[model samples]
Target: MTRTGPVEIDEQTQLAARLRLVVGRLHRRIRIDGRESVPPLQLSALVTVEQHGPMRLSELARREAVSAPTMSRVLSALDEQGLVIRTPDPNDARGVQIVLSDAGAAKLAEVRSHRTALVARRLGRLDDDERRRIADALPALEALLVDED
Candidate 1:
């Protein structure tokens, strides 16, 4: 511990720094296509619902780390726009689950495609080495993201 040539970086700090840089760059690129219209938390909520199948209001709110009332308003807006559907939960007589509508699924696909195209355009400009570096880093990045404590 005393004679180290170079101090080892803390894993948490390194991961945080990398995520910040990548997400920052990705957001900048996404903004160019008017994709920044939606707030990050709202977008995250939508993505959560889309990926997690139907979930109760409280469950969605908990996952997004927002208050139930706040999530209720968010879901209200999404519902009014026909982006989410509320269904009675099969296991709970008094509870409802929010699910993505067909329109919502289609919109999500379109938004993803736009982001993918933006990244693809930039990746197309990079040299082979840079592209390979990104591809090689993806698996480790994914594992870091999905690993549970």
Candidate 2:
């Protein structure tokens, strides 16, 4: 059942190595293009709030792999920047929720739009065949992130 020469395994390993490099480069490029007033980590937290609606300081901290106190500081900065607001949690009257302000939403949108435009411009330079190849790989490329572990 097993074939000799390690062709399949070798090819897959090489592909994985190259893919990692390319993905990292692309991420760096996007980040550079999307630079905003907020730091990257804080921007990520803001994006999380926008994506998942309001969340608690502890919940956001946990999701961001940071301590609650650290998250509180981040939230404080965001609050000062008018990027987030504290609202009373309806279900837990004693708790507060962190919600992205309209300004924060606009900022996030602008950053993402800039990043997307960067990629779109790069993609436009590729030939039709190369573009099609990238497009054809979308499903398999997307599947890689489905179950990371």
Candidate 3:
């Protein structure tokens, strides 16, 4: 059911709203703490390439849920920064594949390490019970990302 007024909001709706705000704030905090030379879109693309390995431009665009032209621009910026290498696709001679360069991997690792350290420090300030509660919630948090289909 949908509520037209705040007077009738449901528990689930309130939980969803609170979770979204907290997650967004945490994400922004991490990004601010781990600000890198690469822009957010470009960094996300780089991470995708790293996860999926070398893939054709079309495949990368599809995985990233972006148009080919948009992906192309992101790749171009990464290429200019020497974060990604465009190599001729062996399977499709006419196509090019995107590969994460050594620099890209290092940058990703560095960003993650910084963010993790920041989180660790913050978590350290919490009481043991609070810390355990968050740890226990990990499974549920991860489950939230599962695709329902």
Candidate 4:
């Protein structure tokens, strides 16, 4: 049923849609510019482990919001690449804890440096006022990520 005269969208909804598109596109551009070696999911999982320190497979899976099987596959690939090390959880003999290897830390640093440089270069193209506008919006933008619960 297409009875389209003029579909009304509230201001907040319009802003939400635009924000989502812009953020997604910017993230893609940064990842592409970084020439990431690992796929995004694996990279994200690696970052999570690095940030949270060594954790059990279930914990990593939960933090990454991925199923255990999927996280296992990602970890297996990472282990093959020497980006992560999995060791038996001392408290739970049956479970393994994931640790980010030195190689993984180096990889994350390289990717972050490249992406930061790319964004800095792009920001340099903008005028002073334009840059200030972005800086001013940053706090509000960051607030959007705060978990309500």
TM-score of 3: 0.89
Worst 10 residues of 4 by lDDT: 2-11
Tens digits of per-residue lDDT for model 2 on 1-149?
Answer: 96757888899889999999999999988888767678887998998899889899988998899999989989999999999999999989999999999989988888888888999998999999999999999999999889656
Off by over 4 Å in 4: 1-9
lDDT of 4 at 97: 89
Model 2 misplaced stretches (Cα beyond 4 Å): 1-6
TM-scores of all candidate predictions against the true structure: 0.81, 0.87, 0.89, 0.89
Report lDDT per candidate. Answer: 0.83, 0.90, 0.90, 0.90
RMSD of 2: 2.5
1-149 per-residue lDDT for model 4 (tens digits): 74434434466678889999999998888888878788999999989999999998889889888999998899999999999999889998898889999999998898888889999998999999999999999999999989999
Look at candidate 3 and tell me the lDDT of residue 76: 94
lDDT of 3 by residue, 1-149 (tens): 55466645576698899999999998898888776677888888999999999998899889889999999999999999899999999998898999999999999998888889989988999999999999999999999999999
Please give the lDDT score for candidate 1.
0.83
Model 4 residue 128 CA deviation in Å = 1.0
Alpha-carbon error at 49 in model 2, in Å? 1.0
Model 2 lDDT, residue 63, Cα:
86
